[model samples]
Target: MHKHLLPLALLTVALAACQPQSQNAAPADSGKPESATAAQPSQADRAFADLSKRWLEGWLQLNPINATQVGDHRFDSEVDDLSAAGRQKALDFNKKLIAELDAIDAKQLSRENQVDALILRNQLQGDIWSTETLQSWAWDPQIYSGLAGGAIYNLMAREFAPIPERLKSATVRMGKIPELFAQMRENLDPARVPKIHAETVAKQNNGLRELIDQFITSNADKLSGDDRKKLDDAVAALRKAVAEQQTWLDKTLVPNAKGDFRIGAANYDQKLKFSLNSALSRTEIRQRAEAEMKRVREEMYGIAQTVLKDKPTAPEMPAQPTPEQQQKAIEAALELAYQEHPKRDQVVDFAKETLAQATAFTREKNLVTVPNDPVKIILMPEFQRGFSVAYCDSPGPLDKGLDTYYAISPIPDDWSDEQVESFLREYNNRMIHLLSIHEAMPGHYLEGAHSAQFPSTLRAVLRSGLFAEGWAVYTEKMMTDAGYLNGDPLFKLVQLKFYLRTISNAILDQGVHVDGWTREQAMELMTKQAFQQEREAAGKWVRAQLSSTQLPTYFVGVQEHFDTRKAVEAKLGDKFNLKAYNDKVLSYGAPPVRFVRQLMLDQPIE
Candidate 1:
């Protein structure tokens, strides 16, 4: 889903940093010198803790925007230095951390510590690969625009402190906007940039101005005279910087952009390892995705025939339909569902209503432990739009009890009436229910609340993207199994469509990045095979090109989660409780599914 739109700096912080917690002081030395008689923590455990602490400190210093996002306030007034020297320093820091991790003896550590060490080591190595080898800074303009938008967005979006104090901190960050843009210019080589990256950044650059105007200018009454004046100046400077960046992107970068959006087979494989945090390779993911895509489409065909049986669009009921017949049946069935969507202005209200119903269904059916933490349904922030249509913005692990936003983007005003209709049909009423289940109840919001309660702050912050997205997808099926919508086959039909979407996501990700699939090929897979609306397919095509290795998370993650639960059910038999199993899996926090599997079964984590 590409849930995050922030730069790698902020993302590194979100994925790596834990809030600083007070540790017990070393015991006073006994009269006798410490000896082997005194039980000591394993050396490996000590090394892991030390390395984690030092690495976090260094990371926060290097990427302050991330620090702020994780509720670390010391660096709130600072933005990362994106100069070439700064990048090199970050690269060196990662190398040093990787070396330290390599020295740790994982075999000597307890199972939990061993897993933590493994996670940290892989994360550090991945960072080094991305920064030094991938060199996205040299080519991706989103790196700069994301930094700019996130700097202000993080500050103003949360009320961790008094508004005035945060606003004052924002002024300091805004003061550095020009310098940040200057570094961006020095770091980005237009000749190496991708046209799509430049084009996207050109649009997102305007978001910086929109953010300031919406958050700061609109709330001028909340600021003191000095704060307001500083904000005004900062906003003007940021606007100028944004305009210059757009000019550079349109004139210099886009024209000369010669780099390929595809990361190629080798890069895609390496990045997939880090992104998926799974044992599956790219080849394996494609195989599984292709098989699943076929299976899900067949299931959708059966349901479509059931729902659309007297309609002329309904295909003959058989195990195998001709490709054309299969496509027609799925589209006709989906069109029926599309007839039930909300009007444009009513979309947000409809989502809120669906969320309430989903929450009740979870409680009534006892599908899983439903957290009492409140989730607010809001319009997607302007700066954060243009990516996914909806996202579950959970609070940082350090900031427990804050609101988790289930933000949905409104229809853009510039869209033609036809495009709007296509989009609404794709996100039809039944689909919105599926989305609410995935984004709110027993999905990201529920899992995230449980993740916040894990004893290890490190695990909480380093939650796996695969596990998060996978669990959301898994919950959709779980809810359907629990007889959501009173056991209507129509609901199951839509659920299968979403499953197809997830499977097709993996296929599209690899197809574009590794197989060199063109836009037409990708669109055909989405619109025809997956039965996506034209607008939805087009957006996904852009998303697949704009990012890599991310789209596969849903398919891979869900499969791992499903396999884990099946294994647990086999072992426990009648002793297995659905609520307990779900609670227990989530209680481990959002680690890789393989790690979660080991923890659940009391096996050594490899």
Candidate 2:
């Protein structure tokens, strides 16, 4: 649900590295056996490969800063021109790429490459279908504006370009912000901004203001006198423009906002086709989610029954508190949680220590493969806008030697005590341990580092969100299965609670956008399913509305991974060593777990 995963952002980030600018793919790896290609590839295989390369290159051009960060220098000096014409050009490119990919005789590629080609084609085809069918610009203002802020900040954060080049580009892009905002202002239909979205933007505007201030303060020393003067003037103008825009949003945008976040059945069907990359339709996802939810809930209740069996059964268990008292208890619990938040300097240290602990624990027990590359955990930048609390930014395969950034956002300073308390309770210490395991050791950082060592650029560029999030979620349970919680019921409760969140997200995402559910419905589900307190549920409800298709990946993905592991164990029998299996599993980039199974276990890619 992080807007940072927007297609352009994904493309930029996906191939972020120093790679070729030409549409030609990287020459096939030098040292692999000819058997890797499965005899001579057919015309369709060659066509898919060629189209995939061009599609990736075009995408990189569209998301330059991401390319730079991934070690691709092709677009270091350029920000995307998100003009209408530019978007049209991108659409055309995707359409063409899809056509070329579709023309290929898919079965002719090697089994592994055929799977790659199919997904590659699907991605390009989906890109075209989404842009055209959804008319995303009608609802999301973000599409109107190029993500200059994120792209620039990420490049600077990652140290992708030379500081001087980046600084200069930042200054240049700073001059462009007013125009972009102005254009966005003109292009945005007041009626198209949903009231909730307007409110979200208003909250986000404050962050943008802080971001502008932070940029000047942090980078002041890098500016020359003349350049500083120019940047200062630009910053002042942008601040004034933003202030004006905030007024416009409050007075005009919010008041007149009439946009529907839900696309309903027709559009939801289209989005399912595009976003899901599956034959699964909205109704199907919903049914699957409902069935999955019922199964998971029953399982949890079973766990509960076992845990609580010893207590004497009265007519009913005594009620603990009134609703208001329960709310107060939740608030009090949150306060206790915030007290555990590490001091700022402890951020990196905590990550390093946590990573070491997680790795040592996993490796000592040989629970899973731990990659060798050292991951550098950095403070998440304030300029990057939020949805989720933490994320992993891995170096691209093309940029193999560069460090991985496990960015964890420190709590913002200006948040009210209540907000801080609520957030902390939402992400308490036990939750942090789950998150650390997911983002650092055997989760994304470890998996991503291993993927960078993969020989295939194609695989890296086409990494699956499902695989990434699924692996992280799978690890939460895997850790518990390996006795990470020891005998603590509370720790285990938190883990189930986290998985419940994934389940809740799956339900709520489809519920809100596809089924026309209201905010209240979402909150009710989150509160019940995830045991989330009101504030956290409310936040997630809004997030569910703003983003589409992203929420389901965690649960769906993790389940796929868990299922795949079970199958792998059955196949390997006595040969299955947890470490070796995991090592083999991750050596390929983050492909769909199904495809991963096919590759690792030599199953057909059905």
Candidate 3:
């Protein structure tokens, strides 16, 4: 499953490696006749360096499965602990890492090294705050026991480790599942889990069960007799426990789920700072979004008026759905879209064509220096289920070759004809071009190419999620501004529709999780504000519940980029080459746009 969406900039799981331990004693100095100034790169500095490296190594070890997924095979022999002790160990480790990173002299390192230090420091800080304050462990299904079990199993299936070692770890981890489930069943306070998040977990647990069954069924023939017997027994136990867990989830967990879904006044404020590394509060974000929404809506309305000037009643297209017709209309719309899907290969080839086109277009316009070798798009695998139409898989910094998987998740075979149509209506042909520009071509792929070449190891490791996603989001609009539509009205309309998605994502993510919004509220907003197809709107509602504030970055990031570009244009005057500006901006790796802006303006990175 290519769950990792933003290269290393997304969240990470690390393969552990052993390093020399730092001595525990603090540095001391003999008394001097006169007070001595602190020495440069002093003993304390050396201690900080040693501790920081060890902490990084430990983080890698804690996430063996994630490491393997990203091509780091060293931790393939271990599965992480989610037990009380495990959680404590994780906490202690993070705290120590934070202290060590803090002790270092940020100014002493190279500029790239300084950025690396900042990224490491920031990730740890964000992790600590989001966890300790938010206590996502209490609510997030993605980190729940069942999901972790599936992650471990998926890693084993990859077969990246030595056979015996892999089997031994798999067997041990498999055996531990019954206990893990027991712990989860006992420890999870149904009352504490948010209702939507709990429901999502139930849905995800169902998916995990299929993975367990598939694991046993797929590997049954390959295992040795005893190994097969152990795995078979393990699978049976797991399936039964998962089934029992599912019943509990439905009966107890779901029904009793009572925590507030909305992050609300306080937490939303904290999350904005954590997820975005920005001081902008939820209120501020909402204000900005509301202003943009009104401005954009009026502009769109003006465009609408131009097209329908003679018709008095044609102020805007009414949804025209009576109570009974609403669902019917939605179903009809989806069915039409699904029927029009390009053959699967054609979809892949479409991505390729867009990449080539984007590359040539950028070069001709001197938009930015394109990488010599870029990422390639591939089809999404069955193991990774139900995400938006497409996403980009970026190269890990440790991995040399720049391979991009432009994963397109086509309609499932079992989807009803109507269901497929509804999906496609939301992603009409022009919208597809906009999506292509964002995910491949001059968006994610381009940003990734530039990011990979950044000189700092730390920056590479801690690339900003906002920058990556934001660049892609910004590109969709930038291309439109640069005359990408070829004068097609429908294309322009779809582009605005897609931009509405970015806007809607920001508001809905905050609304659902932080404002205690209902599905109906989110649905109405998406449909009315964004003019989204209902089915598509429904999926966004679910996605917002599963993920957190992440959806807002696209709108926020794109706006920041646009603001930066405007500032640069003013300063550079005639010297402002778009290509030079872009190349220099991306070359610093994925810093927050403000940080990138500061660097572009030759200001310190406070």
Candidate with the greatest lDDT versus the true structure = 1
Q: Can you write out model 3's per-residue Cα lDDT over 65-99, one digit (the tens) per residue? A: 44444444455545556566766777788887888
Candidate 2, superposed: residue stretches over 4 Å from native: 1-4, 8-43, 144-146, 206-209, 212-217, 223-248, 279-284, 295-353, 372-379, 383-386, 410-420
lDDT of 3 at 362: 66
TM-score for each of the candidates: 0.94, 0.84, 0.79
Which is better, 2 or 3, measured by TM-score? 2
Give the 10-residue window scoring lowest on summed lDDT in candidate 2.
15-24
Q: For model 2, how big is the CA root-mean-square deviation?
A: 4.9
Pick out the ten consecutive residues of candidate 1 with the lowest summed lDDT.
24-33
Tally clashing residue pairs in candidate 1. 0
1-606 per-residue lDDT for model 1 (tens digits): 425534353233243212223221211111111222255667776777777777767766787776666656677789988787888898889888898788888898767777777777777878788887788777877777777787887777766777888888888898897888888788888777778887777777778878888777777668867778887887787778788878887888778888789989888888888777798888788888888888888888888888987866565665678887888777777777888989988989999999999999999988788878878998887766777889887766554366778999889999999999999999989999999999888798888887666656566656788888899999999999999989888889889998899999999998999999999999999988888899999999998988887888899999999999999999999999999889989877688899999988988888
Q: Supply the TM-score for candidate 3.
A: 0.79
Task: Evaluate model 3: give its lDDT.
Answer: 0.62
The backbone clash count of each candidate, in order, is: 0, 7, 17
* Segments of candidate 1 deviating more than 4 angstroms: 5-40, 310-313
C-alpha lDDT of candidate 2 relative to the true structure:
0.64
Candidate 1 structure, TM-score to reference: 0.94
Q: Could you tell me the TM-score of candidate 2?
A: 0.84
Superposed Cα deviation of residue 38, candidate 3 (Å): 24
